[model samples]
Target: GKKVIIIGAGIAGLAASIRLSIKGFQVDVFEANSYPGGKLTEIIMDGYRFDAGPSLFTLPEQIDELFALAGLKTEDFFRYKRLEVNCNYFWEDGARLSAYSDLDKFTKEVAYQFGEQPENIKKALDKSAYIYKYLAPLFMHRSLHKWSTWLNKKAMASYFRIGKFGLFHTMNQANQRQFKHPKLAQLFNRYATYNGSNPYQTPATLNIIPHLEFNKGAYFPTEGMHSITSSLYTLAKQLGVNFHFNKAVDKILVKDKVAIGIQAGGKSYDGNYILNNMDMVTAYKTLLNEEKQPTRLLKQPKSSSALIFYWGVKKVFPELDLHNILFSKDYAKEFKAIFKDKDIDDDPTVYINITSVQKANDAPEGAMNWFTMINVPNDQGQDWEYLKAKARKAIIRKINATLHTDIEPLIEVEQILDPIGIATKTSSANGALYGNSSNNRYAAFLRHPNYSSKIKNLYFCGGSVHPGGGIPLCLLSAKIVADMIPKP
Candidate 1:
């Protein structure tokens, strides 16, 4: 059997290992961190457990496909339940809106809270669903560069409907046109952050994100987000896949422009195929030193990063849901601060998630774990310590004002993760959550391809490469790489 060496034990790497092993390839995974899951990790503090990254769960069918490929039942290994309420939004004008999973309930909630016409909300959702219908088969299911894509009838139909997909206008502009209320526009425009793009700059193609969450439904894992990593890792190990933890890969060994193996921990491991799950910037600048990098593509602006504060609160609120958002007054200014100014906004939108709401064991008898986060620009040599302090103060003030509760006294433990920490921990350049910013309409085509055109037998997967970021897309990237590998 052919041997495959996968760099980084992230979701993409682990998923690739499962697919390749099923195809009769001997797979070995190397991880720099002691644990797997990359950003989809968990933390426990003072009797409260918090999911470190990726608080939202959507499109679980992608995960089910992986388990089915391994001949295992998804329910037996991992389990998740659909959320009744997707998220709770708190606007600066003291408006509270509940985003229900049910389409009718959500439309009614929009009407009740924002005074938006139900017909308008229905029309907007219809447009979002239309975009999804036009693009899903072409953009999400398969690689765009494949010859079969051009030949497929569905793909051609998607190409014909591309203009209607809102590729020209920004998501903010599209939302404003669909909804008369500014708050309603803000609600839909916020979907741009699903992939960490600025709504003011990101194309309206991102409006399709709502359908993935609302129509398809949002989910919460039974155990926690980390359960995804644990279940997949367990399955991979059962398949005879070797995992080498704390082994940092130094370089990709190449012979005549073909990948041979990887150099890690001052040792060389020979393999027939190499899969890189590391960020594209680091993979090129560090691993493939001799190879010519894509300079123009690499120079594109990166997606926004995040500043997360994990607080072990001594109390819980009945009004708060599992996922909550405290939106800033000026959404456009917030995006400008992240993209153009490259600074943390004083009035940044804050997202707070509590796992204890679903899984009781995640916290003590009456306590809660608050995973508070705010979007910021990717690292560009900013003074983070000062910014972190300022941002924390602002976030706390916003939460207290919106919730009408003094929350400062309830903290039993506190920890902070900034852009620098995210970069250092995951080796993502500038600590970008998603690889590159999709502000440009051509970003989908311009992203680094899954298979390296310059190097033979070398493939790339994860947020930094094709198909884009988040758990589902990262898993799709792995599938693309596995499909590209020839059968023995």
Candidate 2:
């Protein structure tokens, strides 16, 4: 069998390994960390287990497709149930909304809470579906950098329809124009942060995000988010893929415009093809140091990072669901604090995801694991110690005000993950969560391609490359790369 060396055993890398191994390739995956899953790993605090990264689970069909390709039952490896209640939204003024998976119920709930016209809510959801329908096949499922993608009649048709389906407006502008109440607009505008983009600057095309959660339905794994990694790792191993942990790759061994293999742990392992699934910026700065860098793509504005507080709360509120959003009063100011001022807003929008609600074993009896997070600027030499301390207070204040409970005392155990910590741990440049921000409508076309332009037999896959971030997109990136490499 032909050999393929996969770098960084992230979600994309794991997916790529599975696909290539099925295609009759000897897949050898090398990971820097002792365990796989990249940012999709988990943490434990005082008997409470929290998914360290990528809490929200959507588009599980992407994972199912891999197992299907292997002719294996996905349920045997991994399983997830669609959430009936997608998320619970809370405002400071005592306005609460339960976004349901059922469109009729959600429309009625929104109408009851915000007095928004049910027809308007449905229309807004239809618009999101419209955008996702035309864009997914062309921009998301395929490689944007390839000429064949633009030349194909079907993809070209979809590409041209973007002007019609995806309105030329910022997420904030589109929501403001679509809804009468600012609260409803703010609720929809929060979708931009799904990819770590500023709603005020990111193109309104991002509004399609709601379609996934509401229309397709949000889901939670039977175990926890970490099970996503564990299951995939197990599947990859079953397919005869090799994994070497704690062997951080030193460099990509390239020769005469061809990727030969990689140097890791002071030794070199040659392969027929090399696939880099690490962040593009760090890969260029370190792995491909000798090669000419794609400066423009690397210089593009990075997506916002996150400040996560893994708090093991001693008390559980039956009112709070698996997903909860405590919105900021000044939504625009909160975004400005992240993208412009490069600081956390005093009243930042806080997202609290509790897996314990779904899997009781995640925490102690009557307790919950709070994966509390707030979007923040990526690393820029700022004082993270000060910011983390300040943000912690702001978060506590926001939670107390919205939940009507002094949560500071409920904390039995606490652990923090800042941008600096994320950067150091994951080797992600600036700790940008989703690689490049889709701030502009053209951001999709600006992302690095799935394969290296200068180096032959060199491929790229991951959130940092094409098709963007999140679990689904990362899985798609791997499919794109695996498709690009010809089977022996």
Candidate 3:
């Protein structure tokens, strides 16, 4: 069997390791951190647990498939429930909307609160579902860069239906055309941010994002989001995938434009196949320093980063669920600050994820663990200290005004994760949550491919590569990378 080496033990790395090992390849994974999961990891402070990154959970089938591949039941190793109430949205004007997982309930709620026609909401959802059905088969399931993908009947059919995707217009324009109410349009437009994209600039095809949560349904693991990592890691270990934590890969040793091994700890460990789970830009500049790099892909606009405040509150709010969104009054202005001005918005949209709402021991009795976050531009040598300070104040003000509570006083324990910290921790270029913004219509195709074009026997996976970021996409990247590899 050919030996394969995976750099970084992120979700994609772990999944790739498992997939390759199952395919009869000897797999070894090297992670710079002491633990696995990358951005999907966890943090615990003062008995309050928080998922360090990616709070939302969708696409349970992707996680389950890994266990099934190992001849095990998903429930035995990992378990999750579909969230009945996916998220509760709040506006500055005291208007509230609960996005019920049930389509009928969600339509009724939207109609009652925003005075929009129920059928209009339903029609929009139906369109979103339609777009996803076409796009997922074309864009997600396979690599766009490969000629084999384009020759398919399904992809050709999807290409013909491209006009229905509204690729010419921005997401905001599409939403505005669908809904008469500003709030409803804003709600739909926010879906662009799911991929770290600007709604005003990104193609309306991204409207497919809402369908994932609303039609397919949002979910939560029984233990916590981090369990997704821990369980997969456990399975990988059981499948004989070797992991070397706290081992930073210094160089990807190449010969004849082919990946042969990695240099780490001043030693060389050779392999037949090498898969990089690190951010593609960092991988090129650092590991593949001597190799011909893909400059155009490396130079794509980095996606928005985040400023997170993990607070252990002494009190609980029953009105809040697993996910709550406190939207900015001026959505367009907020994006401008992120993409154009390269800073946080004065009125940034705040997302609060309370895992303790489902996991009882995540916080002390009568206390809640609030993972509060706001989107900001990625790291660019900015004064993060000043920005974080200003953001804290602004976030506190927003939360207080929307929730009708002095949230600052309820903080019994606290920790913060800023862009600088995220970049340092995850090795994500510029601390971008997603590798690149999908602001441009071609972003989906512009992402770095799963396999390197210039380097043979070298592959890439994770949020930084093909198919974009988020748990599901990262997992899909692993599958695509695995599919690209020859059988052992």
Candidate 4:
């Protein structure tokens, strides 16, 4: 059997290991951290457990597909429940919107709260669904760099219909055209942030994100988001895949433009195939160590990073759901601050995710685990300590004002994760969460492909590669890499 050396035990790396193992390849995963899951890992502090990264769970079938490929029942290994309330939105002007899982309920709620017509809401959602269905086969499910992908009849059909996908207009323009109310437009505009793009600059193609959460329904694993990592890691172990923790790859051993193995921990391991789950730019500079770099790919503008405050609250609110968003009053100014100025806005949008609402064991008897996050520019020599202090004050002011509750006294434990910490921990270039920003219309085609054109038997996966970031896309990246590999 051919041997595969997978770098980073992230979702993509683990998923690739499972697929390759099933394909009769002997797979071994090397992770730098002591634990698995990369950005999908967890944090435990002061009797509170939090999903340290990727709080939202959507398109769970991507995770389940791995189990199915291994000839196992998905339910036996992983379990999750569809959330009744997708998210609760809060506005400073005393407006509260409950995004319901049911389509009719959501449409009616939008109509009642935002004064938007139900017909318009349905039309917008239908448009989102149509865009996703129309482009999934061409842009998402297959590799754009491969000639095989372009030759397909489905790809040809999708290419011809690309004009209807709204490549010209910005996401904000699309949302504005669909709804008269600014609130409704703001609600849809938030979808651009899913891939760390500014709605004002990103293409309307991102409008398809709403369909995944609203129409397909958001979900939560019964054991919290960490279970996504634990379950997959467990499956890889059961498949005879060896995992080496705390082992960082120092170099991609190459000869004559062909990847041979990995050099890690002052030792070498030979493999027929090498898959790098590390960020693409970091892999080139740190591991590849060549004088010449992929200049164009490296120069791409980075996606926005995050400032997360994991708080162990001493109290819980009945009104708050598992996912909550306190939107900023001036959304455009907020994006401008992050993208153009490279600083966080004083009135930044705040997102709080409390897993204890669903899994009781995540916190103490009555307390809650709050994963409070706000988007910020990727690291660029900014003073994070000063920025964090300012952000905390701003966040408290917003939450207290919107919720009408003095939340300062409710905090018993706190841990902060800034872009600096994220970059140091995950090796993401410039601490960008989703790799590169999708702000440009061509950004979809600009992402680094899953397979390296310059090197033979070298493949890439994870957020930094093709299909883009988040758990679903990372899984898709692994599938793309596995498919591109020839049968052993």
Residue lDDT tens for model 4, 1-488: 89999999989999999999999899989999999999999999989999999989999999888999998988898999999999999999999999999989988898888788899989998999989998877888889898888998987887888888889999999999999999889989999999999999998999989989988889999999999999999999999999999999999999898999999999999999999999999999999987357789899999999999999998878888999999999999999999999998999899999999999989998899999999999999999899999999999999999999999899999999999999988999999999999999999888999988888999999999889988888999999999889889
TM-score, candidate 1, is 0.98
lDDT of the candidates, in the order given = 0.90, 0.92, 0.92, 0.92
Residue pairs with backbone atoms closer than 3 Å in model 3 (clashes)? none
For candidate 2, the lDDT comes to 0.92
Per-candidate TM equals 0.98, 0.99, 0.99, 0.99
Residue range 88-161, candidate 1, lDDT tens digits = 99976688999999889988888887788999988887888999898877786677777887788898888887
Runs of candidate 3 exceeding 4 Å displacement: none
lDDT against true structure, model 1 = 0.90
- Error at 63, model 3, angstroms: 0.8
User: What residue runs in model 2 are displaced by over 4 Å at the alpha carbon?
Assistant: none
Error (Å) of candidate 1 at residue 453 is: 0.4
lDDT for each residue of candidate 3 in 117-147, tens digit (9 for 90 to 100): 9888888989999999988977898887899
**Clashing residue pairs for model 1:** none
What are the C-alpha RMSDs, in order, of all predicted structures? 1.0, 0.9, 0.8, 0.9
